[model samples]
Target: MPRTEPRVRRLAAGLPAVAAAAVYGWAHWCLAGPASPPTAVAWLGAVLLLVGACVAYGVLVGGSGSVFGGLLLALALLLTVTAADQTASRPATASCVVREVHTRLQGSLGEGAPSQKTVYRLTLDCPGGYPGELKDDRAVAAVGEEVKVAYDPRRRASPAPEAETSPWRAALCAVLLLAASTVIAGRRPGPATRPRPGFTPG
Candidate 1:
């Protein structure tokens, strides 16, 4: 088959996934109020889920039409959607003081592997009478510093801070996934490749 044919097939396979991402992105903008930072667990779960799905799909796509790929693809897309939703919505805003700062080092052991990176968390006194803590890749402000927080007032007892996410980043991820899915589809075994057990050339 021509190289372009495989690529086109792959892109077609990924169209549904891309459309889903777009819908979630739109819903996020409509529902989420303002942007704040998401919790550590939320961010970690989403990233890990996406990365895991990509790796799993990469391994299983060779099977061609395996349900595993579709399942993982769905999970990854769901994470992407949830991330968008969390990023877009914050019903209320308040000024809070950074009561404390905490940091932790994270990485795995290997030669020339990824180096350890520090994760920062900030404890804040959220407005509307609730205290909250938020996590981020880097500290947005220093301890004892006053900062603005965006939250959903409905959860007055334990309001979660809004995490800022770039729409472009989500778009880029969708594009990359579409490309990867296309490549995998192109690599799938064609109909002619089936073996006949008793066939032989005499």
Candidate 2:
């Protein structure tokens, strides 16, 4: 309740927040520009924010009548859960044939250049594997026929064939954040271990 207490608590609570900010912010700058630092920092923000909230909750609003505090805590927790879900979910992959592949005209960014884009509509029925080179199919599929397709469940819109990219660094960030929050929230000072009044020095 004292001004000094609040100030001291703020200082203590600020260390990790400041560290997370610095690390993740640099990560952002590197990922978007350098292209080798890592692409996981974007997800790291949620973890950092959650850990910070847990620390803040313990310090700024540990006593009664802390409705706003609880709300902030819940919001941060939810953000972390969602981030974990996003990071943990695996991409589903299936193969679809090029029943139809063509270059269609497209426009974007308030410009009219008539861009050429490749679009593929798979013919069904082939199932399992896709045509390796289009000329290896035993029975070529017609417009109304079937074809094989490969796609990701998480990224259904984006097709990745033979794509190799790791998201471990990102998920590790979430796990670390979760662990930090748990530790801070559950931490408690141990009982004093000094000699009692009834005890004598050896």
Candidate 3:
């Protein structure tokens, strides 16, 4: 009976992570489908429900482990939103003429080191005024040059040439995060031991 108890506890602790991953996978699949994605209200409702669930679980569970679980759930929410954004848009190509070209040096400090890189922003004029602008690290087009731009027809937003999303990356990340969250939750610290009364130092 004692042995079975630990197994049950572990499963219960890990269930939330598994559920989160499944939810994210479903969202990604829906976003990638031909049908329209969920409306903003639906997304907001889901977010609210998830947040409420986490809060309720933490309050009811009443353990340090719940803290970690809540954090993981929050992270899952953010990842789901990002995956939706990446998959909701259908890729389309348009030919445009560069109306203006601007260049700037973007710098960042990382790992105690500073680095600088050039970024090129191009204003484009397409037949339908689609993908009116683009930015990239490489100067792929010049002013007055004709170029093919990839964009989302629905949003009319142009993502950088190298910023394309991979279909499997989000799934892989969700799976990995789920595994880590499960392990952390399942292996949560056990109750601390107190020394027996009248026990002297050895």
Candidate 4:
């Protein structure tokens, strides 16, 4: 019995890692496919599955460090899946008229007087029922000008002239979070000590 206990514990500890990997693989397969854009229902289902896996791992591991690490792992998986989805899917295009244009200065107003970049927000009206606003650093269109905007009808998010989706930044963050989770989950709890015979409560 004593020899079997250690093996059981080792197997339990490995379960979460396996589960996390499985969830990541499933998400990539579902979201990063070259088929039609995934529906809102598909997205919701994937998110729920990912959350359930993380929660199950946390509960099974039964440690503060493990729980926290599971959370970090969940976040990393979410980012990675989202980046993959955005990178793989193709967006629909529509011609929109720029209704209004607003500009704002972004960056630090510091002691050294660093240069601030201008951010442009454009309100657009599209014939394809795409009524949304877009914000970007470049001034791509002027008021009353017609410009082409790319959008995902499934997401119904604000359309933009260009889809600036890249997986590198999100992938980088995911890698860092995954590393932290591995380090934390691998940590063993400190040894417990009993009070000495002469020790008394303070």
Give all candidates' CA lDDT scores.
Answer: 0.54, 0.39, 0.60, 0.63
Error of model 2, residue 26, in angstroms = 6.8
Error of 2 at 151 (Å): 15
Worst 10 residues of 2 by lDDT: 106-115
Worst 10 residues of 3 by lDDT: 187-196
Pairs that collide in candidate 3 are none
> Which candidate leads in lDDT?
4
The top-ranked prediction according to TM-score is 4
C-alpha TM-score for every candidate:
0.53, 0.25, 0.53, 0.57
* Comparison by TM-score, 3 against 4, better one: 4
Kindly indicate the candidate among 2 and 4 with the higher TM-score.
Answer: 4
TM-score of 3: 0.53
Error of 2 at 122 (Å): 18
Compare candidates 3 and 4 on lDDT and give the better one.
4
Better of 1 and 3 by TM-score: 1
Error of 2 at 97 (Å): 13
Residue 178 C-alpha lDDT in model 2: 40
